[model samples]
Target: MTQEKYYFENPKSSIRSLTEDEIEAAIADYENGVKISEICQKYPKLKVSSFYKQLPYKLNQEKCEYCNNQIYTKVRKNGYGNDLAKLCIYCNHDYTKNCNCEQCFHNTNVALEEKRKELQIVWKNFYTEYYNLNYTLNDISIFDEIYLVLLIQSYKGTFENTLDFSYFKQLRFQVHASSHEYYSVINNLIDRKILIPNIYYFDSYDYIYSSEPSLPTINSTKINWIPNIIKTSGTLLSVSELDKILKERTYSVEDKKILWREVYWSEIKSYIDYQINI
Candidate 1:
């Protein structure tokens, strides 16, 4: 058995487990008079998988040496003599580790699954926005998605409109991660054209606003690619019109970079027209 603790802190149940002898006794009681629910309530540490190991009707089946759970085999041995019942999913060896944590139902595997589901909702909205703009995201891992969410939240909506490379290093990484992670994502963003490092830093003030040798008077918004312009219309668009329509939608350097766009020539034309009108 693996002796290392499976929990970060004290687990929900401290007892090791109900012994096989105790389980057999319980099964005997269940057959005589005791209810199955009462037996389960009495031995809360006994998992359903473990309980099934003691069922009398099941024949010729062996208990997993590690966890003592029933190994229900369908197909026989493979070419290498490996059977489907060779290993339990949780404990992958002959001996099982002791993990009576609150979850196995508050365990790491279940917690991560739940967290992944939560993140799906968040990423769904993010991807849905890009889908309108003819962009998409590839298969990203759960851990990366978690880190991305944390990174974006740290920015507090400042990067949503603008992909300012100057400040990517400033935001706090959630789990004490190194600055290299942010820098890596930044470089990728630049490659994706999500972060035009100094899109707003043009020296030609004459081209921006009239009668000022300085930058245009801007608000708290970050300037993003107009969202869903192609999905909304096939006609040519002006930059001024795009700005008006997509003023409310914004993209941070990170958000835009994560999106993978499938470019349409017509959409590109509209975008070029918008830029030309600007």
Candidate 2:
């Protein structure tokens, strides 16, 4: 009778174990709109909390609703007072705003304005030098031709198809014996600061005309280029000259310098063409 009192051990375990196939099936059922509780019920061994833990990893398999981008499983805060929201890093959007969810627009606008100002300064300096070179070579002789070729090639980093030096020989046949002489002149010009080597290429024919050598004076000095134009024409020469020319037809030292470097070179060509026939 005592021997008949032995009991059988329980086969069911507290810890639930699911195979890879079973897990995939659970995920597929949840994706098909089945509730987590229902999934647990169907699995019998799967706990409710355990199903929620698997939910994130499983739901991340789907794509984002906004940009059709892949959804990321990691949750992040939307902003102040908002709960953690799901977002696609590729096309981030806060669903609450009802806008294309992205980072703050204010920051983006500020960044763009700063970049625009920087680009404007760069272009202004580049154009100023270009105009200076055009004025320096009033008649465009062999020296001017070679200088221009080197200048363009220097700044642009490489020679463009538009630059051709064959015309220099046709002009009065006074061309140098060889092009090497032109290179030597350019090298001397670089050393004298009349030309600045290309900032990009350390060792090459690339060079930019320098404005430093022709800086204008601040006082009402000689009629060096700019004041001459203002005196000849009753009208103001440029925007910088409008105030000075209208008030006294005289420019402060700084303003005169700026006018000479930035505007005089471009306007000088037209002024000279009108004054002289050659």
Top of the candidates by TM-score:
2
Count backbone overlaps in model 1: 8
What clash count goes with each model? 8, 6
Q: What is the C-alpha RMSD of each candidate to the true structure, in Å?
A: 21.4, 21.9
**Per-residue lDDT for 1-278 in model 2, tens only?**
11211111222321125655776676567556577778778788876664433432223455666566555442221123323345455566434454445553544556656654554455356536743431122232333334443433332222221222234334322233442332244333333333332222212111222234333111101111111122233431331342232434344687556655544554565577556756
Candidate 2: C-alpha lDDT: 0.39
Taken over the whole model, the C-alpha lDDT of each candidate is 0.38, 0.39
TM-score for each model: 0.20, 0.22
